[model samples]
Target: MNLKKHYLITMIAILILFFSIFSILTKLFLNKGFLSIEKKYKDTQINIIQTLLENEKYSLSNIVLENSYWNEIYNAVENKNIDWINNNLVYYFSSQYDYDFIKILDKDKTPIINYSKYDIDLNINKIDIINSTFKNSQQYTDLVNIDSNFYIISSSPIFDGLGNKAPSGYMIIADRIDTSKLENLIKKIYNFESLTFLSNKNIYFNIKYSTYIPLKNNNNETLGFIKIIPKKDNIKDYFYKIHIIFLIIFFIMLLIFIYFMNRIFETINSKIKSTVHQIDLISKGNYNIKLNSNTNIEEFDMLSNSVNNLSKTIKEKIDENNKNYIEIIEAIMVSLEVKDSYTVGHSHRVANYSKKIAKKLNLKNIREIEVAALIHDIGKLGIPESILNKPERLTDDEFDIIKTHPEKGYKILEKISYMDNIKHIVRFHHERIDGKGYPLGFKGNDIPLESKIIAVADAFDAMTSDRCYRSKFNIDQAVDILNENKGSQFDPTIVDCFIEVLNEDMEFKKSFAL
Candidate 1:
């Protein structure tokens, strides 16, 4: 699933599980509390009953225990024609127990005494409770339902000084047991804002419980269930606080994971860039550059492998062609040299000088300088091999034809796309800064740097090397000639670069031999 849905389902399921467990635990706790309250209620009732009994209130206990006491007392009262009995025993029971109503009855079921919150009566139907009591005892308890109100009637027969514990009428005390002492006890059990609503299946708990209190019965026996619910609004805010805590933790962990993933990807990308740069260089014929691929990464290994393979083929092809192309240039230059071996390595010398001066000038860019030096003498292609090999001076027509070689060579390499830049160098190598050189006769900075490089190299080699027409100048003569013509025939800017190269006494130091 998508991330949102995935997190949504997982978190929702977790929340649901959490709430379910919370609800179950809440129910378990409340049930224990309800049970405890029930037991407490029962215990309190038992305590009250036990206390009254211990205080010699057996008259009331006997009423609760006997059945025929009501009728015996009612009959005795009726026969005596008493309005109300003057016994201190039932009155004491009433005073001690908070009984709202108290009464006595004769054997004929007449009321001996009766008292209410505001009234008194001398008659009651003891026959209504005639046979309900503990066996053979003149005591009884009858549940009376009147006007939809429920009350308990406890009746007991009186006794005389004689050893006969026979029935002698009865006394009754009525008290309301709807007191809310049980609820007060529950309040004590719950936390400050907690409560309960009784229902069949659902319970709500307001607090994460500090303790659980089960209900109790009137006999001090335990009841196992209690319902707890919140009575205030702060509980939801508690969960909100919890959500904030969990959310912060989750995002922090997520950010950490993302950061590590980014670091790993960055490392991978860096490695890939190195591989691409190496492959790109090899593609463009820069075999001298190293792969340095490290060979551990698979793509790097592949790139390194590809470059090595390509270098093998390129090395073979370049090896195959190098002798042929160099021989052709050498053969042509040799025609000049054969006419006058004073220019034995003239082409080679010019190429070296061009490259050196370019390097010294900080025009150290490789490809352009290479192509420029390689074809700097390409214009001589049109020079007649016979006269170029001539040992003596040429006619004016032949000299004009000789000067036309630069323009002619420009046209020769002009159509070859890879060699197009070579033509400019070929065309301007003979041009002079004094506006006196043939072909374009371009002056100063108007000459391209490539052309200027070839110009310096070509002039230096020509002056130092002997020709069929004249003796070669010495190194100092060549240097003086160049210095004298620095701004007039050669660009002084490139001249400085040329001076540095000559001072280096580079690889092609020997002058052309005649």
Candidate 2:
């Protein structure tokens, strides 16, 4: 991806990371805090209900104790007055106290008075259970389950009103915790959404934060559960709304920040591209071109100024080097002319002929061929003057010495940096098309094309020029010699181009006239 896309993606990633961390924090601390508050509130409400239930049990125990301590209750039990109990006692207990069941038992645990509003089982077995339950404590006030219904049952020993004698009987009173009572208690506590009594299943909780209150009997056996679901908390809803608003504001802020950052980076990117374009021009040797200096960024402005200075310095150095290179070539040519005056005309005419042949052949490096031809015999400086100026045919040993000139020329030109391109041409000019006649016998196609062109030019110039040994051959004889030597001594294509140059260009042909 490009820098802009990468930067945008990175910014978006950071934004997402920030929100993720915020969400985790909310879950860990804030949401947990709300949950903790809800738990405490539910615990408080459950405690209130539990306290009210305990108070109801205490009130029931007080009523049982007061009734059992009365002298009339003791006389009624002792005299066996069922009619008196029915007329007075039942009306007082049931009408005033809202008692669900009333039972009077003698000291021997035989029931005397048994009155119930809902036909509750007052059987012998149940009576035995109630007696057994209060035999140890002598008093009972607690919840009990009868026929799958919950009730508050209270029991006390009956005695005389004045001086308490041995207890003559026991009095028991119970108040049922029916649906209306539970509903009234809940309505007094808080406005709840719903109330449900659950069975033995342990998993009773549902959505909307329901509170499960288990109802157990005096024996601690679970009878049922009361589930209270309160209305949703307005404060919690308010907190959630605030957090949503904050998230929206944060998102808007992030977008605005990214937009400004994108604008800034766009300016920087434009400046960078401008700077790179100028540097590219400099790399391609457009030394005269200047970098844009008006980029407002300080670093880019400084870089532009530095590159401009560097370009000026490089262009000056290159111009100075070119001037020194021309002087070096002139000095080498003067030295070669001093060594052998005949080579002055011979090298110049050979360079002229090589240029014409290169142009006729449509070769790109015509100047390179001319340079190699001019320096093709520079290695003759290493040859003895006696060998170079010999009037007669050279013996085998002397011909071997003459053949070393091409290698010597390459070695001399290799030291000049600008002349490195033409050094190979100078070294391989004498190599034949068939891999013969060279210091290193490079064959056709292996020889540089500039070297082939110079080879044909050098031969034509040498054959047409007068030497100390013999008079020079005419132009036609030189051309015939080139045709005969094609593919063996001279490259056939270069020979043909040279012959074509001779036929077409009168100036080049006049230079080869005897």
Report lDDT per candidate: 0.52, 0.71
Best by lDDT: 2
Write model 2 residue lDDT over 172-284, tens digit each, in one string.
78898876787786574455787776666565567456777778665667777777777764235544754565466456545654666655555644664665566566645
Question: What does candidate 1's lDDT look like per residue over 1-514, in tens digits?
Answer: 9986786566556544544553344334434433443344333333322222222222234334432324444444545545334444445556665565676565544666667653433134433543442234455554343332223456555544331655556556654322243355333322334333232234343324312333332233432323333344223333344334434433443343344443444454465466556645554556576665573544445445544654454445444334433443344454435443434566666777777776777765644665556556555544545446667788898789789978876765553443556668778878888778879778777777787778877887788766777877887788788889888888888887677656676544453323
Best by TM-score: 2
**TM-score to true structure, per model:** 0.39, 0.45
Question: Which runs in model 1 stand beyond 4 Å of their true positions?
Answer: 1-344, 365-367, 506-514
- Stretch of 10 with least lDDT, candidate 1: 49-58
